[model samples]
Target chain A: MDAAIRFHGVGKSFKKKRVLDNISFSIPKGEVYGILGENGAGKSTMLKMMANLCLPDQGGIEVLGQKPSWELYQKIAYLSDRAKWYSDYTVEEALQYGKNFYPDFQMDRAEELVEFFKLDRRLLGKEMSKGQEARLQFLLCFSRDVELMLLDEPFSGIDLITREKMIELIIESIMERKLTLVITTHEIDEVEGLLNRVSFVKDTKIVVEGEVEELRLKSGSLKELYREVYA
Target chain B: METRVVGSYRFILDFSQPIYEQLVQQFRQMLAKGEIELGSKLPSVRDFAVQMKINPSTVVRAYQELERDGLCEKRRGQGTFITSSADQVAGLRREMAENALESFVEVLKILGVTQEEAQKMIAGVEWK
Candidate 1:
């Protein structure tokens, strides 16, 4: 089993507060992995480290068998809750920005996704709603044919209909590209359908981790298992 | 009567069983009830997987199980189709009825109802 990303004794601290403490896990290649935990569980910090946006305070992390660096960031796509874009940039301009920044970005795919998502190109980044922003962020991420995708709370700002479409599109893209996706979401039941494996993070460590089915068999459902672990 | 999916027409998987087994069972029930017509094309592995938001490999395994059960057959390169066999259909019906009756009788035994009482109840109840 080849690993897409491996974390070895990884620890991160923001000043006095330790966000992650000696956490270690490996995401297998071509798998949809879910990193699940309550808010303030260091899920966002961990994803940041994986994407080379931040460095771990202790221990090592590797992506594609090599240490994480800005160079490797091209192979990894990160979609965060507070994604940055020029306030005045239109949807088409944002696509241009993505293509200019990431050589792996496919303009055709970005256009297709924009059309599929029904994002109004005339709307400015600052003018669109949270749901529309989520769509644009996803469009930018999926435009790049990368190995690893780190998604943080993708379902929060979107409506139910858009969220369903996002889930369906995520599955379609994953199957088509054989991507390695690591998602952090508190909505366990919503994402349960697409997850192959899940890890429950607590107290700055992975409290439990296993295939979704095994976890379910052990504790009824993912939500129940989450309650049992976090209870 | 023992449906595997947690929802209607659309499928939603549960954790108690592997996805392929659930899919196989669901397809078997569908065949027995004539919900899926014999000799009709089944959804492709990718299409079904996408619809269910599950792994395509699981869908493939489900189709394999269907073929093994003689409920469906795959025409290479084209797609899988419900097997056009009258004997197989009749066998499926019998098996489904036996399974339902077996569970029904087990419940009756647990409830301490005698066979004669159950027969009388069945006869007294009007079929609508």
Candidate 2:
């Protein structure tokens, strides 16, 4: 049981406002881990630290058994909460960008996903709806053969059908490969079945963290636990 | 028979309980009731995971429990299959019946019903 990501007493601050305080946890390889919390509870900050998108003010973070580096970035796919595509690029061009930039990107899988998600190749990024944009972003990230995937608020502002499709793709990816996924989302019930483990962050620290099934057996459903912890 | 086998396993999972335990219980009950045909191949771990929309590890756990209980066997390079032995099936059926009766009696005790009253109720039931 090797760890795919580890955070040791990590802390972060933005303009003197402390967001995360002394966070510590580790996600095992091939496990689907969820970082659950309300908005601005430092869930996204933890994901950013793993992706090397932000620097921690204290302590250290390790990914794939090493410090996060440019070389390691190639092995990790980080999908941001605010994913913005090149407005001028067509759907086909957007996928081509992923192929050219990510050496691990599979064109065949991308093409298959494009059809599965029902995206029009000729449609421009600016012309697509919110749900369609989310689909495109997810497919782009999912087409890569990365070892660790960091998804921040993947289901926010998306339609129900699109969210279900994303969940299906997540399960399929887990089955097909040895992938460790770290996702932050408010929609806990939707991904409850997919998460092997979860950590609930509140007031800049993890209030609860353990195997989802064990926690559920002791307390209740994750949704009920979420209410008890955050409500 | 193939359709029946596939149709019987469409489980609407309840997350309040341990998911793997629920899967194991369902399979155990189905095997005891002769619902699942012996020698039929179960879905592969990967396929079952996708079909059930659950983690593959959960499916593996349930399948391992089934194998350990002698209700199923996994052949190398082949999928898991239900036990073809009538003796094993009969054993499971008897064990399941005993478990059910024990639970019923326990509930009756909790309700403060005497054994004589329980026997009378059982006798009053109309068997199909």
Candidate 3:
């Protein structure tokens, strides 16, 4: 498989707290990978580095075989739990803004997703409910025809029904476009079925990474293994 | 038939065979024993993941295998369901058991156990 992203001896820190320590992993093209960790496990920080929102304090990071830069921004779509949008902008306006930034943005898909999530195009971002905002964020990120997508807590704080819908949407998008996705979530069970591979982060580093079934066969159960390793 | 409510559908399946093959065998057992009723809702990937504390992705793969084998049907937004007919399950079980037996014999032979000795040992073990 082609390499979509690579990290080499990557380390990041905020003040005295180290977020990622000597992290190294390679994600293959056209694969849905899950990054699993508890709170404060460096998943978000690592994802930020991959998105080039934050530079690694040490080592190197690459996406689609190149270092992330403003020129490569269009090739990557990043969604996080704290997706910030102009509060006064309407749903349509948000889509328009996204298209301005990402040349490959799919306007039709964005419109379809807006309708799918039942978000009113006229409604301002600030007026939307939390779930609706989340749906909007997801729609915008997914509507971009990018090579790599980094989703941070995409399902967090959503109701079960919406969460399921979001998961289905993500799966369908990946299948339709063959986009490489890296999702970070604490709710492993929710997204576990959708991932091709899983990587566990602990002590500011990736401690486990491999195909999901192979890990299950070796450890009996992933939950058991997680407790054993991180307990 | 009394439906035994298994708290979670997620199974931490352990067998000498591969994960997908092991899942197929377990589904067969569930069918043969009538533990899973026809058209009954199998555990959702999330529910199963929580039950087994495994990734939902593994459950999805197993469920996909079941669908491919015509042992289950997936309903969008709903959970997977067991096929109504028992014939398919029975046929698959027979084929799987044959393969499993062959593997067992091969391992025993590798361990230098004679057929007679293996049979004797099998006879000595009590089936619960």
Candidate 4:
């Protein structure tokens, strides 16, 4: 299987504080892969590097078979934990913005996702609740026909019902588009079943990575391995 | 379905499947049997994890699976509770069991266990 994302000797640091250390891994195409870690374990930092939002201090990174750069930006959608929107823009405007940046953006699919997520197209981005904003961001991300998606904490601030809907939407998109997703989240339980594989991050490094069932059989549970690694 | 309070435990899980699916199926079955009692507190995610000696995430996955099937609801700051539509649990159980049985029988056959021997082995189990 072709790799959607690959990191080689990837290292990052901020103001002398190391975040990611000698990280190396590959996420195969058409798989829902997870980056599991506790808060401040550099989960989001690694995702940022993969999304090309930030450059690694050392080593190489690839997204969609190419070096992380502006050229491949449209082929990948990165949703950070802190999703921002123009206060004056409506849901339709956000979709349009996405279309402008991403050549593969699907307008009809955006509309369908908005409807499915129950977001009002007329509601201004600023007027939306936290949950609604998360849902709207999710809708926009899903609407983009990207080859790889990097979502950093997509479930934060969302209600359980909305989270479930978002997960189902993701599953459907993964099946239909054969998209590869690398998600970082604290809500491991919510995404456990959906993940085909998991990469456990600890001490600013990837300690374990493999098929979910294989790890589950060995560690007896994802949570167990997480505790053993991070605790 | 009737729930019997055996010993100090409020309920029992009678499925002869893998522990993970058994945990999920039994929880749903408890709700269907009214043993969970709507509004009654189910086990905590951590408590269940310790009891099963598995990861809390696995317990959480099981609960999330149950929630997705609409057999349970999780309230923020409160524990999960049985849903009113517990009858749906029966359909889910049948579907899951059928899938598991298919794989189980296939594996048994692959391991050189004849259908008759499998049946005999299954019948030899002493049920209380």
Q: Each model's fnat? A: 0.45, 0.67, 0.08, 0.00
Interface RMSD of each: 2.0, 1.2, 6.7, 10.4
lDDT of 2 by residue, B1-128 (tens): 01112334756577777888988998988888888898888888876776676778898999999999999999999989998998999999999999999999999999999999999999999988
Per-residue lDDT of candidate 2, residues A1-231 (tens digit): 699999999999999899999999999999999999999999999998898888899999999999988888888999985768557888899999999999999999999999989999998989989898888899899999889999999999899999878888988898889999999988876777778999999999999999998997998778889999988
Clashes of each: 0, 0, 5, 0
Clash pairs, model 2 backbone:
none
- The predicted structure with the larger DockQ, 1 or 3, is 1
B42-70 per-residue lDDT for model 1 (tens digits): 88776777667676666777889889888
The model with the greatest lDDT is 2
State residue A2's C-alpha deviation in candidate 4, in Å. Answer: 1.5
Model 4 C-alpha RMSD vs. true structure (Å) is: 12.5
Best-to-worst ranking by lDDT? 2, 1, 3, 4
Question: Taking the tens digit of each residue's C-alpha lDDT, what string does model 3 give over B64-128?
Answer: 98898888999878778888777876776687778889999999999999999999998998978
Ranking by DockQ: 2, 1, 3, 4
- Candidate 4 local lDDT, B1-128, one digit each (tens): 12323222343422122344656766665555545655556677645543333335456777788888787789999988767554565675676678889999999989999999999998998977
Q: What is the TM-score of chain B alone in each candidate?
A: 0.82, 0.88, 0.61, 0.53
Q: Write the per-residue lDDT of candidate 1 for residues A125-229, one digit (tens) a residue.
A: 889887888888888989898988999989975788778678877878876887899999988756866788888999899999888767656666777788888
The positional error of residue B107 in candidate 1, measured at the CA in angstroms, is 7.2
lDDT on C-alpha atoms for all candidate structures: 0.83, 0.88, 0.77, 0.76
* TM-score, every prediction: 0.87, 0.93, 0.72, 0.67
TM-score of chain A of 3: 0.94
